[model samples]
Target: MKAVYIAKHGGPEVLTYGDRPNPEVAPGEIMLRVRASALNRLDLNLRDGKNYRGALPRVMGCDIAGEVVTISPNAHTDLKVGDRVILDNRTKCGVCESCRMGLDQNCTNGKRLGVDLDGGHAEYVTAPAANAHKFPQTMSFTEAAALPIVAHTAWHCLITQAQIRPWDDVLIQAAGSGVGSMGIQIAKMMGCRVITTAGSDWKLLKAKELGAYEGINYRTTPDLSKRVLELTGGKGVDVVFDCVGADVWEHNLKSLKPGGRLVITGVTSGTKASMDLSLLQGRPLHLMGSGGRSRRTFADMMKMVRQGSLHGVVDRVFPLDSVAEAHKVLESREYFGKLVVES
Candidate 1:
């Protein structure tokens, strides 16, 4: 099978696209004819070996949508060969206490697909049979491929972690990002007023179209916290979904109302930030870091997608063989939504 693999941790240049040994289906696993895969910032970090190091020659892609090719004899699922499914990114030992409680992402033995195992950057891939969920007939493979990571992450951050309420004033950072695009729609779906930030005018315009009540151009408005305060009539937002990390850490703190919730998932910007203990204590804020969303969350988001309440925003699609170019486009941050690589 032809796949892209990283022989060593480095830049996009290290990605090799060529034929390799075809993956054989293992017991309790499901083999897939990979249809499409989406790129995430985690892919870039794993490629650079910044976090979650893996063995050499690892295929890298997390958001996968494909057709079932074969199911192991030991595995059981409602899906069968030719059924379209979305691969869950989070893998866990199902017998673990966390898994028993339906918190697969919190399992101590959890390993992410594409990070701990070879992922769907190829014509064929395999996943735990339990990780495959049948997608709606209305969803295209490209659309399903673009959803898992961002939708699950945003759902966990806003709904599960932040416990967001209707009419809450919410601020989402980097609205042009995959997660931010989903965050905007989810917040709006919950009846919250959403304010999102983007680096460019067109992205801000697009963010508004996706349901953001207001868009902030962070390039022009350096003190974005002040803008938040003004937009909120001096009270500040009730919840902040911040993925930019350290670069906007202080601003995120200041943009919140007293006791506001701030949930962070990614550190695209640098990871170090200085915070004032006095301000933290005075405001009694709830600051949380969320990652590795549970399978349940992914399934719930997919259900919303099927109902037409939530949608995946895809920016572009590249052929599977052109993964290097896809990486370049993702790194440039020139796209407004998720980037998909089709097999």
Candidate 2:
């Protein structure tokens, strides 16, 4: 099987495409003839020598949609050969405290596909039955491939952690990002009023097209929080999704009403964020940390995709052998949604 791997961690140039042994299916696992995969910032991080610190020849892809070509004889009701499925990025040790509570991402012994093991960048890959879900036949593999990561992230932060409700205004910082695009759609599906900030005019327009009720251009807006307050008629937002952590934290915090929720998943915009402790105490804000979605969330989200209420916006496509290019695009932040890799 031919797949892409990080020959060394430095740049996209480190990505190598070549043949490797076909993965052997283990009991309680299924071999998928992967048709398409999507690139996330995590993939780029690994390529650029960030969080992923592993041995050489690391397979770097997490989001995948594929057909089950073979199934091990575990006889689990959740899986069978010939069923179309999407890979779940998170896996857990069922014995862990978090896993026992169905919070797999928070599991003490959690593992991520692609980072800790081989992922779906090749013609075929094997994954635990519990980590892959049968997808709707009506959708394309490219679209299904886009669901696992961002959709799960959105579900985790907004649905599971924030407990968002209808008519609530939510602020999504960096609405042009791959996760931001997913967040916008997710918030809208939940019946929340979505507001987002983008770095470019094109990105802002793209966010509006994806159901954001209001789009603010961050590049030009000097007083983002003030504008957000005005947009909500001085009420502020109920929740603020801060993916661009340091750059948007203070601004987003100022935009939130007293007792408002602030959910953060990533610090994509550097590591430091300055906050006013006085305002935090006076407002009694609910600052929360959210990341790593569960299997249940991924499964329920796929149901929404199958029903046509949620859509995966694909920004670009590259052949499985061209993963280096995929990493480049993600790092450039030129994409409005996902960068797909076809197997």
Candidate 3:
């Protein structure tokens, strides 16, 4: 098999593409003829030495969409050979308390693909049967590859964490991002009134095309909080999606209405945030940091994908060997949606 991997963490240049041994299929696992695998911030984090250790060489990619060629005899009844599918990169120990409660991502003894575990940056990968979902007949492999992580994160933040409701006004920062663009769509799906921030007029127009009630160009209007207040007639938004932490932390906090909630799923800008102690009492706010979703949550997200209720807006496609270039593109923050790496 040919795969891209990192022997040592440093930068995207550490990603190596070359011949590799065939993946071993275990009981309840299937080997895929990988058609496509998408990149996530997690891939770049692991490659740049922020997340994983170099104890084991790593093939880094998370969302995988492919056709199954070989299946272990012990595999369960839900799937079989020749099935087109998308595999969730999240794994959980079934016996753990969180797993028993259906919170698989929070399992005490679990692993993530492309981080602590080997992932899908190859021509073949072994995926657990439980983590694979049959691809919809109408969806292409490239589209399927873009969904598992971005769509799941958007669903977790809007539907599960913030509990968004129809008619509620919401503000999403970095509206041009893969997750942010997806988040805008998901919020619109729930009938929420949404305002989002992008850096340019072109990006703001793109966000508007995706159903944002209003688009604010952070580059043009530096006084975003004041603008938000004006847009809402002095009533701030019901929720604020603040992935641009530290730099935009206080600004986002000021955009929310009294008793409003803020859902944070990432900190691509910076991790640290300086919160004013009095803001808690002055506005009566709630801050929530959400990570991966539960098994049921991801399944529900897949259901929407199959039903055409949610669609991942992919920006570009890259080959497995061009993993380094993909990282540089994403790091530049220029793409409107996701960039996938096809195997």
Which candidate has the top score in lDDT? 1
Clashing pairs in 3: none
Ten contiguous residues with the weakest lDDT in model 2: 72-81
In terms of lDDT, model 3 sits at: 0.86
lDDT of 1 by residue, 7-96 (tens): 898898999998878899888999999999999988988898878566878988988999999999989877789999988877789888
Write down the TM-score of every candidate: 0.97, 0.96, 0.96
lDDT of 1 at 92: 81
The TM-score that candidate 3 achieves is 0.96
**Prediction RMSDs, each to the true structure:** 1.3, 1.4, 1.4
- Candidate 1: misplaced stretches above 4 Å? none
Q: How displaced is residue 71 in candidate 1, in Å?
A: 1.2
Stretches of candidate 2 exceeding 4 Å from the true structure: none
Question: What is the Cα-based lDDT of residue 97 in candidate 1?
Answer: 90
Query: In candidate 3, residue 305 scores what lDDT?
Result: 87
